[model samples]
Target: QAQIVELQKQLEEVTRARDGFQTELEQAQKSNTELTENNRGLTANIDKLSRAQHEMLQRARRADEALRVLEGEKEAADRAQGSANTKLATQEKQLKTFLEANEALESDLRKQMQRVALLERRKLEQEAEQSTIEAYYQARLDEMQAQYDRLLSEIDDSKRAAQQEVYRAFDDNAKIVPPSPGGGRSPPGKAR
Candidate 1:
């Protein structure tokens, strides 16, 4: 009976040890299941993060293309502005040249007008001088004509007296006297 008691105590200790090992196994299995579920959740979140990262990359590429297009447009605009500035400078130069030409023409016109005024004044002076000369000549001519008429009248009077004396002498003597060549001779139907 002493051996039997000792054997019984050893069996009871072995049985308790087996039950404890079984309970530990069940707890281990439960902990593994919870850990597996947590792993699955973490995998799903990683997948979503990966997709978000891909979408962000696509958006970045589109933004880069848009920036390139805007830069092209800006370059074109800068070229157009440069061309316009060149055209404006050319036009301004042309306008300046035209204004200078107009000023030169105006100066030439003023000079020509002054010349014409001088010529007109000279013409008037020449006409006035010619008129004075003509008047003086006419006055001299009239004076000479008056003197010639007076001399002609005196010559007629002398000729008539000489002819009367010669006729009276010839009538008293009853002698024929020759008529002088320069006597008061008159043509037919005309008086001396």
Candidate 2:
């Protein structure tokens, strides 16, 4: 009975050792599984972070290009505004010149109008003088024509009186001679 008791105790101790080894092995296997799951989670998070970083870089590049484009547009707008201002200034100067020229032309027109009025007055005065001279000449011509007619009538009367006196002289000087040999004065009776 003593030998059997010693053998049973030894057998129990051996079984307990076996049970402890199995429990320790099971715990190690559970830890290994948990560690594998953690490693997988870590790998997935790293891949997500990498993808987010790449997207951020691409967004930054696009923002830089947009900024450059906006800067170019702003510069172009500034240049256009400058050109418009220059054109406006040029137009203003031209308008001023045109106004000055128009004023000068108006002044010249006024001077010409005054000159024309003066000339018209002078022409009227000259016409009046010419008419007066013509009237004086016409009166002189009428007087000369009357004197010429009187002289012609006086010359015709003198010619007729001279012709009558010549006839009377010729009748008184003529004498009648006798038919006999002796010449004697003819009597009022008939000659024998």
lDDT of each: 0.56, 0.55
Q: What is the lDDT of candidate 1?
A: 0.56
By lDDT, the best candidate is: 1
- Check candidate 2 and list the clashing pairs: none
How do the predictions measure up, each by TM-score? 0.41, 0.35
Positional deviation of residue 4's Cα in model 1 after best superposition, in angstroms: 99
Cα RMSDs of all predictions?
Answer: 73.4, 74.4
Clashes of each: 0, 0
- TM-score of model 1 (CA atoms): 0.41
Off by over 4 Å in 2: 1-83, 158-192
lDDT of 1 by residue, 1-192 (tens): 444454455546555555555555556556556655655665565555556555555655555555555555555655788656665555456555545655554565555456555545555665565556555555544554454455455555656666776787666767667786756487568866
How many backbone clashes are present in model 2?
0
Model 1 error, position 145 (Å): 1.7
What residue pairs are clashing in model 1? none
Task: Sum up the clashes in candidate 1.
Answer: 0
